[model samples]
Every structure is written in C-alpha cells, then in structure tokens.
Target: MLAGKRILLIIGGGIAAYKSLDLIRRLRERGAAVTPVLTRAGAEFVTPLSVSALAGEKVFTDLFDLTDEAEMGHIQLSRSADLVVVAPATADLMAKMAHGHANDLASTLLMATDTQVLIAPAMNVRMWEHPATRRNLAQLLADGIRVVGPNAGDMACGEYGPGRLSEPLEIVAAIETALGQGSLTGKRILVTSGPTHEPIDPVRYIANRSSGAQGTAIAHALAALGAHVIFVTGPADVPPPQGVQVVRIETAQQMLQAVEAALPADAAVFAAAVADWRVASSSGSKIKKDAGRLPVLEFAENPDILATVSQRKADRPGLVVGFAAETDDVIANATAKRARKGCDWIVANDVSPATGIMGGTENAVHLITAHGREDWPRMSKQDVAARLATRIAQALG
Candidate 1:
C-alpha cells in the first residue's frame, strides 16, 4: 500500500528512538523511500550513520549546513515529501509541533511542510498524562496532525500508563493510512457506535449488551481508507479509534441529535444498538422501598435515528447503512427492516447467545440491499469492517 511513497522521517530524542531505525527498515521493505532527519538529542541515542545506512538516504542534521542548503533548500526538502513522520515524538517535540516552534532543522521542516504529518509519541507516563500534554494533543488534532500511539504498558521510565511508542508494524499501518489513495479519500462519513443509555433515575438506566467492537472497527477502517469520519459513539467497552472526529453521547436522543448535526456526509452507518423504548416518566430521584408500595414505569418509543436520516427530505446522505441484530429469521427480518427503515442497505447478524456474536470479537452477517441478500462467512470484526468499508468505497465511486 505504501509503494513509491516519499516519507520525511524526523527522529525525536527518547529511549524509543531506537525503534525508529526498525521503522525505516519496515517502510523501505514496503517500497517507501524515507529521508531521515535526526535531532541533536536523537543523535545522542541513534547515530546518524546508522539512520542513513538504514534509510539508504543522506541524513539531514544541521539547520544551516551550507552543502545541504546549496543542494536542497530546507523549504524544498520539507515540501518534497508526500508525508512527514515523527517517531519517538517526545513531550518536547509534541509541544513544539503543537505550538509551532522551529528552533532546529527537524522542527523547521515540520513548520514549513505543506504535507500531512503523523507523530508517534513516546514519553514518560506522567508526562504523557499531564495537562499540558493533553492540551497539546488536542491542539495537534485540531491542526490536522495524525497521531499513531502511545500505547498503554510498562514504560522504560519505570512508570506505567500510556507512553510506549507503537511497534514498527503498527507505525507502518499508520503510514499506509496516511498515504493511501483509496476511493474514499476526502469523503465525509458518519458512523454511530455502541448502546444508548436511557436513564430512569439519577443512577439507574437501561442499556443493551453492545460492546461497540464492530462499530469501532468500522470507523477505523473508514479512516484508514482516507475518509473524514465523524464518529458518534456512546459509552462503550472499548476505546474509540484514533484519527477521526469523535462525538460522544449517552442516550439515543443525544445520538440522534449528534447524527443530524454531522449531516451532508457521503455516507452514514448506524451501527449503534439504540434502545427501542425509554421511560415515559423518568424519576428525578431514587425511589424508596416501602411496604405495599409499587412503582410503575411507562415506556415511550425512542427516536429512530436510522429511519429519520434515511427518509430525510433534504441533505440526505448518498448512502445510509443500518444494522439489524436479530436472533431469529435474521435474513427475512433484516430484509424487511432495510425497506422499513428506508436505508440503502442493512447488515444483519445473528446475535443469539449461542452464536456469541453480540459483544464478541467475531461476527457472521448477511448484507441486505435492494439487489439481494449475501451471506458472509463468520470473520473477525475487523475483517467485516474492512469489507464493509471497501463496499462503501465502491458504492460511492
């Protein structure tokens, strides 16, 4: 996927700088040409000779190297690559990138670059969790810089949280995503995930068993395909995917409002297991137990987000996909549901306890459309998401 790509790699100072060498090898193996820029602190960890040898390209170090500037101006070098990648992006580096500080050659190139930037942060757990880091992360995201990972695990700093740089292959995957020329590039996609909570009291609420694994995977797949995804998610078992516009909501009504707010997209996928009903008269406080006293709860139908969006009179999405989690008559029920909901397609799955699909890692589903129904073999949720994303790409194309 990364063939013939030009990547300008900036190695930041950290214990994780060693991994950047391996990253260069991985990128080269996939036919990507990497230009190395080693920071002064990064040089303390990895030698310029090593980086140059692995990258098969001259290493750029000094900001004012007369020979380098004569051969290729800093501005030219920065604008030459398709993408810029910062590996072992330490706290100092992230803050600089976030705040636009260009004191050194690497930071200067980062500031001058017109291309997309991807950073793999590596720092102490406490530094990673600090308020300043959080603020910088938010700023970077807002500035359209893609972040790979600071995966949670034991750190070299003897602190454990989220400060480990992603593995070489994981960084490669992120690079591929950044440089992909997929069909969904520049497309806007809306995706809803997880189960909604309908509150009955201050502490009590009703919800489904949706783990949101499938929806999260779908959002990741869409983003990997280069779609600008608007992810509307509810309280979920797993964390949401990176590199997407995430909108968190708690209830079906909130989900609906969020979905509507993210309108005029090329596609919308309603993967959330929204409740069918909510308490008509929810209690403000906890109900006390008393002898011969009973509390009756009335039910009201929740807003059908899928149906409403699909049947919109204006600014409807080009493609609207809904999910049907049925235990019996799966295909038949889903086929009817697709028509009833007025969606372009319905992905139906057997969520019975025997299948272990609901809240499970794998899924077996039927794709229902106006054309017909196609039964898909059981596969990991990630596989399903990739397939669905590809299908969406094809449909949009």
Candidate 2:
C-alpha cells in the first residue's frame, strides 16, 4: 500500500525504539524507502547500526556534522519525504514538537518539515496521563499532526494502562491511510462480523452459516480510506483483517458488550449474523442422551444490539447501519427493519438456500433508507464493501 512512498522516520528516546526496527522492515517490505534519524536518547535504547541496516539507508544522528550538513541541508532533508513519522514519541520529544524546539537532529527535522507528520507515542502510563503531556498532546493535535496510539497494556515499568505503542501492522495501516489522503481520515468506525455462537452445553452450541468474509471486507475497506476501524467479530471461518483493532467474541451478549465499549464512533455497521435467541439455561456439562427420548430446551431472546445502539441517547454513532439477511421479502423485510431498528440505513440481501449467498462471496443487495431503496447489482463481497465505504465517506464527508 505504501509503494514508492518515502517515510522519514524519527526515532525518539524510549523503550519502544526497539519496535522501530520492525517498523522499518515493514515499511520496506511494502516498497517504501525509509530514512532514519536517531535521537541521542534513542541511541541509548537501539544502536544506530541496527537501524541503518534495517532501513538500508544512512542513519542521521548529528545536526552539526560537517559532512552530513554539506551533503543534505536540514531543511531539504526534512522536506524530502512524503511524510515524517516519529516513533516512540517520548514526553520530551512531544513537548519539543509542540513548542517548535529544534535542539537535536530529530527535533530539527520535525521543526523544519513541510510534509505531513504522524506520531506514535510510547511512555509510562503516568507520563502519558500527566497534565503537561496532555496539554502538549492537545497542542500537537490542534496543529493537525496525526497521532496513532499508546494502546493500553502492560508497560515496561510494570504498570498497565494506555501507554504501549501500537503494533507495527497497525501503524502501517495508518500510513496507508495518511498517504492515500482518504476522505474518512480521522474517522472512527465500528464494524461487527461473523455468526455468534450461542452455547447450549459444554460441548454444543448454535450458530449460522456466516463465514465473516463480508464484515472483514468492510473493515478493510474502511481502514483503506483512513478510518480507524474497531472490528468486533465472532468466531469465523476466516481470519480478521490486518490494520484494524479486533475484538473477538463468541455470543450475542459478548458482541454487544464489545460494540458498546467501542462507542462514540463516527459511524457503525452491524453486519454480524447474530442469533436471535440463546439457550435460557445452558447446561454446565454435556447433556446426556442415555434414553431414546429427546431433550427439551428453553430459549430466551438475545439482546438486540442494533436497536440498542440506534436508540442510545448517549454515545450513539452519527450514522447507524444495520443488515438484514433475509430468506424472503428481501426489500420489504429490510425496509421494515430499518424503521423498526431506528437505524439510518439497512443493507438487505437474500440468504435463502436457493440464492447460495449465506456463505457465498457475491452479494446482490438492496439499500434501504428514509429517502428510498436502491437495488444494487450482484457483485463480489469486496466490491460491495468498496461501494459501501464510498457511500459512508460521502455521508460523513
């Protein structure tokens, strides 16, 4: 996705500097040319030799070196890349960037750069939450500098919270979006996929024929357009897409919880084939069939995730989309569902046995909205996802 792109990577002082090694390799693997600028504090964590070897380019460290200055001036070097990225953006580094400080080679380049800037912050939990750091962050964001993550997890300081660097692949996804200048950049999208499994016993569960292909395609499409996708998915036949924050779940209730937790999104697409009912009293152990008699089971309605979110008075997404996988009366059923669920739109498709769409790749869908309905031609799931993504960008543009 980053083919032919130039990324000027500034490594800052922090434990996360080690991840920059993998970041360099990932960017190169995608055909991007990386130029490394290592800070003095960064050198304490990772050797310049290792960074240069991975980047396959010279590592710029000193701003006053006569040879380096003569070869490429600081201003030219800073503006040479398509984007400038600071990995392990420590508190000190962020402060300097916020205040336009140019003490070292890294900060100097950041201050001189005319290209787009993206930062991945990594610090102790306490440092990240400090009021001063928070102020600096607000300033950087106000200046339109893109920020990726300091995901919450166990930190090197033996503390846990939002201070870990995002994974390399996640950053790569963000890079793709930034380079694409996608319309949905900075938008947070929530997507649900796969068939939820409702447990009946320790060894048995009920599920549908959903493969999660469509939902995975949707998440990938949104991410490609620079949207941050929170992919809440059930166990499926296929793996979730890369470049997304994935929340794995098994039942309708769990999916609902995950979705609610990822709220305040700009938009949400509920595509999972969630079962309507679950075993009212699931057996802790396997149900024994010693006799020839069949066992009776009680069922209870599962939580209505779509309606719940659509009707939410707080943290409701600006645009809510629901899906109707119908066997009959495709458009009518879906249209009614759109009104019943109070969602802005409904993507309805026939999943009847005759249609072969339950687990199939292609889909012929009808889009139902307050304005009207649009019957779309049958197309590959990927194509459908692309179309939907474009429509979403238009709606939220």
> What's the TM for model 1?
0.59
Q: After superposition, how far is residue 60 of candidate 1 from its true place, in Å?
A: 1.4
Candidate 2 error regions (>4 Å)? 1-181
Clashing pairs in 2: none
lDDT of each: 0.91, 0.91
Tell me the TM-score of model 2. Answer: 0.56
lDDT of 1 by residue, 21-56 (tens): 999998999799999999999999999999999999
- Model 1 clashing residue pairs (backbone): none
After superposition, the stretches of candidate 1 with alpha carbons farther than 4 Å from their true spots are 185-210, 220-397
Error of 1 at 254 (Å): 19
TM-scores vs. true structure, each candidate: 0.59, 0.56
